[model samples]
Target: METDGGERSISGSSYKRQDEKFKSVRRVFRIMDLVSERGEDLTAKQLAREIGTNLSSCYYLLGLLVDEGYIERVSQGGGYRIGPALPSLHQGKPRSDFDARIEPAVKELAHRTQRHAYAAVLWDGEVVVTQVKSPPRSPPVGVVKGFHGASHALALGKVLLASQGAEFVDGYIDDYGLEAFTPRTIVRPAELHAQLNKVRMVGVGADFEEFARNLCCVAAPIYSASGKVEGAIGLSTTTRRIRDEGQRMTSTVQRAAAEASTLLSDEPDIKDGKNRKSG
Candidate 1:
């Protein structure tokens, strides 16, 4: 009734069941990998290409995933990003792995520079603070919340503007009307453009009390794996400390900023608040 290998016994009805389960698991992993790779959004057709499968097969797999809540169908933001089931992707893994990586790098910068280390990602034209870690003994200046910035003047803001391109920034300034938070803020459109040019070349930017007098900040842009400037990260310190400690941070911040780019590359699709929605 069975072959000499004994597989004939298990490979019959039992082996059929085992093989089906194995295939199912392999497919699930394939889907997860694809979603992680393309963070913005994906059509079934797009997913098919990435998975190197037929469109119909991709659709069926995606449907099963969507039904299982492994990925949510976002109605807004972008489309089809990693879903709420992401926590379970690794069997309820700790939430701090990515944050853990950014923390030490930032804390080191903050410790060395004596400033508040912060990270910002541009979302829908507004910058959102994804990470913020303060150094010991550093005084606060109330600059944490999202859009707690002026695109024209803040170092991070200018870094973003410069990365977006001149005309795009110019148009934004003309429309929004620079708030001119302090005497140091640059209100002139041409001047801001010129400053952006320098920011582009220098690969760093300084706030110089533009947002708040006696509060100065310096920042560098963070890029994603695709070389897109996904966000900006830097430090903010008081004028006194900046004069003394800020200069020391310039190189550290620059290196950290560059590393931030690589960090993002390693983590392509799962940044906080950078989700896409599916209809």
Candidate 2:
């Protein structure tokens, strides 16, 4: 009887450890899922609150994930978002629905504008180009692969930022300090707010040598079916050339974005907090 009881005690101890391991695994996945679904980053404290974990444990886990490249720290950049490694895990999956619906419109915009067109999404407080189309005669645009940090410096970034509302913009300003990319860049908070207001009013954002010398672009917001801004579509060209075709460029880009907006599942406008007409 003593031998049997001893064996049972050991087995119970082993089972308890296994159960704790399972719970830890579950907690990690829960963190990942919440961050991914939010379409933005979360601070360690915010994540802890959401996940119902103590701050110490949450911070430890978040740090581990960051070291492993499963989550990224956005201290000056923004917040903690899914790490670059996460995308590779989905490499074998088929193209996303956003790609399918937005690509055709992007191509049409490029053809119509006779310039470069691209689709960008606001991920972790940065503008990330997700798709691109360029006129056959145009040279390759080297800006597609990276995220744009200076939201106030680029047309697409500005439009995406403007659609997010005041509170979001404030957090963004805090995450990515506004630094002048060029003399034309809006670095002051009040100045940037005014420009963002114009972007909202016009339904288009403009950049003229703000991000870089000799470069200009115009962007329009793409709304999800629920009416929230999902991303933006932009057309790019040399500043001198775009100056001559400014009105036409804005028209084509806005039209393309309006078409793309229909493809999303939601269309909730973050501005008035209602679903307004895409027009």
Model 2 agreement with the true structure over 129-211: per-residue lDDT tens digits: 66778889677753543344567788998998898787778777877778888899888998888999999998999999998
Encode model 1's per-residue lDDT on 1-279: one tens digit a residue: 677876545547888899877776787687788676663477667767766778887778888887775665545444455553444243223223444446566777767665688876543343445466776765555365323336676777778778878766756665567788999888888788889999999999888888888888888987766676766778887787888867777777898887766665676544433221212
Candidate 1: where are CA atoms >4 Å away? 1-101, 269-279
CA lDDT, every model vs. true structure: 0.67, 0.74
Against the true structure, candidate 2 reaches a TM-score of 0.62
Give per-model TM-scores: 0.58, 0.62
What count of clashes does model 1 give? 3
How does candidate 1 score on lDDT? Answer: 0.67
